[model samples]
Target chain A: MNASTLWIFLPILTGALLLFLRNQRWVAFVAGGLSFLLALTAWLLPIETTLALGSYAFKLSSTFEILGRRLILTTNEQPILTLIYGAAAFWFIASPSVDKAHRLAPLGLVQVGVLVAALAVEPFLYAALLIEVAVLLTTPLLLSGRDKPGRGLLRFITFQTLAMPFILFTGWLLRGIEADPGASALIRQAAILLATGFVFLLAVFPFHTWIPLLSEETSPYLTGFVLWVFPTSALLFATGFVDRYAWIRTAPQLPQILSTVGALMVAGGGLMAAFQNNLGRIMGYAVILETGFSLLTLSLLKTQGIDLFFLLFVPRLLALALWALCLDILRQNAASLSLQDVRGLARPWPFASVGLIFAHLSMAGLPALAGFPIRLAILEDLATVSLSVAAWAFIGSVGLLAAAVRTIAILVAAPAELAWEARESWPQRLFIILGGLALFGLGAFPQWVLPLLNRLPAIFEHLGG
Target chain B: MLLNWLAGVLILMAGIGLFVSRDWRWNLGAMALQYLAAFWLVHASWPLAASAVKLITGWMACAALGMTLASARTEPGKEHGWRDGGFFRLLAAVLAGLVAFILATRLSAWLGIAPPIAWGSLTLMAVGLLLIGITTQPLRVILGLLTLLAGFEITYAAIESSELVTAAQSVITLGLALTGAYLLVAAKEETPQ
Candidate 1:
């Protein structure tokens, strides 16, 4: 079988199988590990090159076609696939700790398969439909056997569905632009539609209210997975558009618009996170800030911008995973994640509290954490363009830092009589410890992964780095 | 031409019926009529088989939702006697439909779309938006979403008539129906009997 079929179809088939074995936790672990191995094989195995195993020799092609459409997973996409499946494995392995092994493992695998399909689909417009399907899949996960689906889930579905028509319409209009490159009216219309669609998809500014609500209402682990997968895939999809169309990437106003939107998301999300009393909402704001940073990177000199964009990927994933794990652990003890509810939780769950603090601090771009190096790089780049913009971005970081400090204070405010104790299971403690180390390792030795990150821009031929 | 106009009238009636009615049974009937009208409209662009599939899947969706609602021991808000700001909502829906019709006419004129297709699609979209915006009920919102998708599909079929697109649209319709059913059941479970 081709790599596309192996990577995409295998996980999908596994996910389907998982649905039947939902009650068995071991199935989730085995299936999740096997899916990760498949993704890794796709990443490492060279396509169109023969491999010999004892007396057999075979080559795995990169392209797979079904129903007149094509899915191609070129070598350049290996890094991205590796990242996606790696994160999936991390989340899946940790699912049992959050009491979501059954639902998240099965459905999450399918969600990843469809999202990867979104990126690989030929004609790309079909990606819009695929994205809607993925969003539909997420509804069940978000509801999670609750008696009633929350308004947040409804809003999430509504906003995501609304983006589909705009994107599909944009694709239709783009044909007009392709036919007449000099047709200013058509180009303008396409641009507006495309930007509006991404705005909704990325949840920029006014469209982002659902982020905090969903994060607050759903399990932190599930919310983290959704937040990570949706925006990352959407950003990658948007990048594909910029890479494919010269007019879109070369639009003089494009960089300015991206920067403006990015700045707003950063400022708005950061400031809101600073005052938030709920830990889940804080995670939500952190995601918004990260998205804002990613957008701002797009405004940089194309090559540098694209490179910096990929740089944010691993750090953000690590920080979010750590944060969600801590939240889930604390949730086992506290009735709610509100500041009032989790106050003095540090006494009973010291490691988890530390993980929470560090994760938040990392997202806030504290020095010696995963998010700091990338945030610094982006800020430096922004300074070259506009120092005022850089200053504003820095202020946003400070807002998040302030929130982290407040959280730390609350966690440490236990009575003198209270004694510290390790409440987390061994596996949970191991995940948290490993996540914390990853944050520090990536921060301290970013060069180790810089080579891989630098290759990310190569996925887009015209987007030089 | 006469059949096209008839299809348009059926679509308009369905949109208006969905707006004015509160009972699930009546809404289901309106939805079925809307899908049938959609089949007729889509027949102009797609194959007869494709159009038939649309109608069948839509009816299937309606059946799934109908069964879910029927199985519930209580109807949504049965005690209130349809006291869900019915008059204002209907008035708002009518106004929205009128505005949407005017906009669709202008849009079609600009895009050079045929009148029947544009009118039916825009009317459905406007009414769907009205329902989704005004109602907090999951069933109503889901119906609105399905209506919106129906409208989008009409316009989309004019541009791309691929079987794949049709199949995808059918999946979206069924998916929305299943989600609506899930939400309806969940709501039922939540209610203290």
Candidate 2:
């Protein structure tokens, strides 16, 4: 079997099997362990090399074809696959602790498979359809058990679906632009259409309203997973566009536009996050700011920018997973996530509250945290581009920092008689502590992740390399 | 060509009907008519089998949504109604449809699209978007989504007539219908007897 089957199809098949399993805890452990193994194999297995097992040599090819379309997982994409599946494992393993493993694990695995397909599908435009399918799959997960689908879910699907036509139409227009490179007007039109499509997909600026709202309405863990997977894939897809089109890559205004939008997202998200009373909304805003940081990173002219972009990935994933897990854990203890509801939760759920604070702080790019190195690199890059842009980005980080401080203050605020205790289960505490240590470890030693990130830019020949 | 024009007219009428009416029966009837009209128009571009699939799936979606709405409460206030600001909404939809028609005409002409399909597609999309924008009612929003998808499919059919695209579109239509049904049931559960 090819790597595509092993990494993409196998997980999906496993997920399907998981649906029949009656025990939720078993589903969580199986899904988590399976995903972790897949991620390990993807990361460690060398493509185009034959391995001898008990005198039987087997080779896993990178390309798999279906109905004349190709799902190609080139050696360059190994890091990405590793990231996706690894993050899935992290989320799934923590899911049983929150009582959401059954529904989220099975569907989450399927969603990852489809998202991987979105990245690997040939003709590329077909990815739009695949993304729509993923979006639909997520609907049940988002709205499950709720009396009615929230406005957040509706808007989420609506906006996401709306992007499909724009992307498909852009693909159609691109054919014309490719036919005649000198067709400047057509090129301009295609650029506008393509930018608009990515804008919607990336939820840049005004389109980003759904993020905070969905975070407020949905389960934080599920929202975090959806938020993480979709935007990562969308960013990669956008990179694909820049890689494929010479005109787009060379367009004079493109970098400036990306930087402007990125700056706006960071500032806007950060500013909004500071005033939020809800932990979920704060997480939502942090995601928005991170997306903004990614856009800014992509806007950088040098390969270092691409390196920094990939550099941000591991930490962001870890931080978000930790944040979401903490929120979910606290949610079990408190009736609501608002400041008033969760006030003094730290006295009972010390680990959860601390995890929440640290995760938020790490996401804010605080010193000696996983997010710090990359955020600093991005700001440095922006400094060369425009000092004001750098300042705005910094301001955004400060906003998140303020929110984190507020969270800590609110969580720690209680009567002097209140006693500190670890209310979370042993497993939950272990994961939280490990996750926290990972944040500090990655922040302290950036070299470990740098090699993996360095190889990511190699995937995009023209845009990054 | 005459049949195509007739299909366009039916689509336009149904598009308007979806926006103007709040009654589930009327909305479902209009949605089915819109899909039927869409099949007729799409048939001009796609294979007979593909067009039939679109028609069947669209009808199934309508049936699914209709059945769900029927089983739930059908009282005037239980679902969305044309009670307050109905005239204003209707007026807004008409104005949006007009603007969309004009813009689509210009766009299609510039892009060398056939007029009949373009008009139908633009009208449906405009009306659907207006409905989605104005209403919070799950059923109405869902119908509007269906209308918009119908318009998108018509436009896409003119450009690409692949079976894969058609199949995907069918699945999306059905998915939308199921989601609408899910929402309706959820709403029913939420409403206290």
User: In TM-score terms, which candidate is top?
Assistant: 1
Candidate 1 error regions (>4 Å): B76-84, B190-193
> Where is the poorest 10-residue window by lDDT in model 2 chain B?
B73-82
DockQ of 1: 0.62
Give per-residue lDDT, candidate 2, residue B45: 79
DockQ of each: 0.62, 0.51
The sequence of per-residue lDDT tens digits that candidate 2 reaches over residues A125-183 is 88888888888888777777554677878887778878888898888888888899899
How would you encode candidate 1's per-residue C-alpha lDDT over A398-463 as one tens digit per residue?
989999998988888888999988888887888889999988998898887876676677777788
Best by lDDT: 1
- Model 1's lDDT to the true fold? 0.85
- Error at A96, model 2, angstroms: 0.5
